[model samples]
Target: MTDAAPAIAAAGLRKSFGALEATRAVSLAVPPGGRHAIIGPNGAGKTTLFNLLSGALRPDQGQVLLGGVDVTREGPDGRARRGLARSFQRNSLFAEMTVAAALMTASAIADGGSAVFWRRFDRDAARAEAAAAIAARVGLADRLEELSGNLAYGAQRQLEIGLALATRPAVLLLDEPTAGMSPEETRAMQDLLAGLPRAITILVIEHDMDVVFDLAERVTVLDYGAVLLEGTPAEIRSSDLVRRRYLGERTQ
Candidate 1:
């Protein structure tokens, strides 16, 4: 493994909603191109930690680092500009827009261009090409002309990832990408994520234990708003602490 600085790092992060302490001194470090999964019980502050990392919510204390540079103060847009992108728990799509149009719009925005209309593409061949490439990468090339809302639920999720990929992000944060998916859809999503190049560092929050174990090279378990354990899947599965706290399994 290379010794490059961590692609994403959280140092002593904390967040509170007045009476509720959502995150308590949580910290993480994900190496470049690493596939890391965060698994936690409900109310364990997974979402809160995600928000702080994405700049959606500022930490009440501590710092966020991107490629070893402090970015705790940067907003979401700023982070995006510096190669960070995220997909939410719910699909975020331009419902009325065609897949091609939506992808083009996202690509244009990433490049600091006016994404007013796809019809006005004569002068934006680069944007169009980038969008097409992203479509192929996300398995949406065949659905380019289809309305985003009209695509199958799984396809819609694929498009959601495509939108994020359009930004050409170096680091991707996926929040429950398969939350509402069927077993088949979940498998497809897993395959899609597995096929992603190592050029992108991935961090995911997922409820599906199978998905977490399948995709993650390293796993972090959270309980009561703090890290309970971190290790390879085998280590975590064998840990009585993780089994009791997060997996809810009876352990000897």
Candidate 2:
């Protein structure tokens, strides 16, 4: 990985589900430390593009590069090992575990520690401390002992992000971190994401225009499985094509 390389890039990525082409020649490059967002209406292929980039699905064409190294062939775990981490829109949690325990487990796995069922997690003081720090970072420090399944919807989302952070990713891909949150929760999540270290590049797929406009330095608009436009937030907001295709505006 060179200093000048993009944190993540896709070149001519294409995917088809049988007869339907999901992503049509989609391509993007997110520079190191860049904050970017992908937005579109329903069925715009945003999820398919994310799957290809995260190695959840292989692209029918083109390549996925992480830190400029081609990773098209790598699976999700392999990409994770290479400093790419992703958070899903739905909750992925250990329902039976405490918030601290869940983060500790994720951190331990990321550090190559095997799960030894016979041992207590807290016995590993460093891992516990790391988990606590992650809990703090994600705004769950005060809820470390709470059962993960019992957390409020917003806190669960925060913990989901904490799980991703445990991997210490160089590039983080978030799938609608603010989804399903109240306005207050959304604002809190936004601030938490905004406060993340600039050393980590972020690429998010979001439907909330407020979050998109506020959090993303650059935005990519997708329509009908292809990029409608890619530009700064100001450019994207003011784009006549974007307005017509995505924002539901009629031409004068």
Candidate 3:
């Protein structure tokens, strides 16, 4: 591996809740501008791991590094300020707000101008332009005027992604972006994600094998809160350990 610092790295990470060990000495590295994925069966601590990386939860042990800086002590807002952003598995949009309004809010927050109540967001040319640009990037330009809650499920998910991009993050953590979707919708989401600018490093936790294979350059399999295996997509597909432990006969 090159000596360049990773965009995100978890070193000997561990976390627990009461007696439950949700993460156990987990470690992984994501190269700058790379597409990496975490996959496993339910209860494999994928979400918990995401929480640690995004600073939603502090690890009991180990360190989280973003762009080579130790951010283990940073909170979610702190991480975001350092160009780390995350999208949840559920729709977290403002249901009553229009897509434009929501995106403007996100852009303003990320730009550290949320306190500028003296000027209307829509009237701010720079913020409005940035919001419109992000909306187009995520394929939500057509729905700009629609109420976020009234959009189709797939559209809602698109909005979620748009919000994440609005932060102009250097590292984005996406959890189950396609959790529930029709085949057509899934394909659309896949295309949208695939088209994202490679300047932004993407780390995704997804259950769909097809999606994982289609999007990730590297795959990390987790089991019982620890990394079971890590390899290229081809290596992961061919590994007997992964097949037997996770992918099953279908991968064979």
Candidate 4:
């Protein structure tokens, strides 16, 4: 991404499922190298917006631009190939796959080298080395042999982030990485996220106000499927509407 261009730009985004309008003409920008947080209550269309941005779901009307390309119509895989990646609120991993195995498989898929996983990975040592490196980076080296389902829930979540990182994406969309985590686990996740290189942009949908304020350089508050406000952490803290609808009239 260039210094002057936005990493992600959404314009007039709208989505409807049956009778409910999930997103209503919402728009926002995640600046280059920015850690931007999206916060809203339940049913505020937080996940739906992520789906639109990540190409998991198409917007009924609008445009999603990544870097400079208009990618509203791109499917998930196409967007991924164009340097977009995301993790969901639920840990999306092969529950039966070992950490090392899962990372190898992910690296193979994301690298776009081959579909013959067993022949390509088992014969090549570089794939194993790369997968191990990614596993260690996410603090899962110790659990390399553990089945994904057998690991703790927080560990599973960490693995999901690791999988997204394996894609070498320019923008990483995190859909509540800290959701359902214990306080200690959440802090660990926050540290891992903060320690990431500044070259990568992270746009996160987070409900934990503490995490948002601690990690996000900019904050976007969504209420009732629209951008209620957008500002720095301090500005968000002082906003009257944010206080009433999301911040509970007191700083979190």
Candidate 5:
């Protein structure tokens, strides 16, 4: 594990949609290269919190810190430039484009080159370099010609992650990456996520406790938009509050 300071920090974060409060002065930190999990019930403000982190939605108060910089007011692109990136749960991708094309597009953005438009991909050396590296890293090398939409659901999710990785983000925020996946696919995703380069930090919000405990070095439990408890997997599994509030006890 990396010993550097947190790659991302949310201090006293708050958000609201009119009278409904989505996030209630929440604060959390993911140390550099840490495998952190944000576990919460539905509507516990997980998605809302993700929006705040990625600059998709501005917070009502507090600040977001990335690489020890206060970027509370920066927009999405600005955050991306600072090595902050994210992947959506809803499968964000270009359905019509082949995997190679999609990856090459990411390569363009990463290499800071012009995007391909109405032309075949012949030899954008820089983009090809980045695309080939990312595709190989994500195990999509063979599926390069497959259209994104034509791939299996798990493959689509893999592409989504591959896109995020193209930026070479120092910290990656994943919003329920395992949602709708079968057991086999879920395990595969877990393995892929776990094997990520140690230089990249990961903060994930997931429902599968097994996956959470398996991947996260530390876990934070939230209920009603407030943090309930935080600790290692062993500590959280034995916490009374976690058992009562989040994991219902099995009746005798």
Candidate 6:
């Protein structure tokens, strides 16, 4: 990809289930190393758009470009291998596995070591070190031996993000990273995300205005399956149209 190309871009994406169009001509471009956010109400096609971008679902009509390469037909794994990773809104983890084990598994899988099932993960020095680094990066180093299912809700969220980071993605799609977090947890998550390396572009779908406003360099407001506004946080916050159509006075 050239320097001018966006890390993630969607063009004229459209998806429908029978008569209900989930996404309507939605298009966006996230610059390399940029932090962007997508926000809308419950049925505003936010997650649907993520699905299309992340290769969870194919768009009926559109193109998805990853690092300037057309990947509309790529599957999730293919896209992931091509430097795109995602964390779901809900935790996706091995509940019974220790945090260290789960991160090791993620790293091993990313390294195409899935067939080495007979060997203990801790025996692989490379993978172990990688896993430990990821754990520290996500602030879970203290809980390495703890079961993933037993982690506090926020820590589980952190582990989920760690799983995504194991792949060393160029673009990370975070779907409500702060969901279900207490105020303290939310603040911690915000700090963790803000500290991520600027080389990794981030696209977040969030309902929490505080997180969105604080972390996003630019905001895309989706409403009725289309972009209603795309601007800096200050501009979005001040847009009378966005306030009337979505943000409302409460978000202001």
Error of 3 at 73 (Å): 1.0
- For candidate 3, what is the TM-score? 0.94
TM-score of each: 0.93, 0.93, 0.94, 0.91, 0.91, 0.94
Local accuracy of candidate 4 as per-residue lDDT tens digits, 39-119: 988899999999899888899999999987898978988889988888633334467677777777777778786545544
lDDT of 6 at 250: 61
The clash count for each model shown is: 0, 0, 0, 0, 0, 0
Q: For model 3, what is the alpha-carbon lDDT of residue 233? A: 94
Q: Higher-TM-score candidate among 3 and 4?
A: 3
Where model 4 places Cα greater than 4 Å from the true spot, the runs are 1-3, 88-93, 113-116, 249-252
The residue pairs found clashing in candidate 2 are none
Model 2, 1-252: lDDT tens digits are 636989999999999999999999998999999999999988999989989999999999999999889999999989999999897333444667788888887777787875454146657788789889989999999999999989999998998999889879999999888888999999989988888889899999998888888989999998889998999999998988898788764223
lDDT of 4: 0.83
Model 6 lDDT on a 0 to 1 scale: 0.88
Q: What clash pairs does model 5 have?
A: none
RMSD of each: 2.4, 2.5, 2.2, 2.4, 2.7, 2.0
**For model 5, how does the per-residue alpha-carbon lDDT over 1-252 read when each residue is reduced to its tens digit?**
956567999988899999988899989899888999998889999988888999999999989999779999899889989999897332334677777777776655655655555134436667667777777776687888888889898878888898888778899999999899999889878888877898999999999888899999999887888788989999999998898888773322
Q: Candidate 6 regions off by >4 Å?
A: 88-93, 115-119
In Å, residue 171's CA in model 3 sits off its true spot by: 0.3
Candidate 3, 142-172: lDDT as tens digits: 8888888898999889889998888899999
Number of backbone clashes in candidate 2: 0
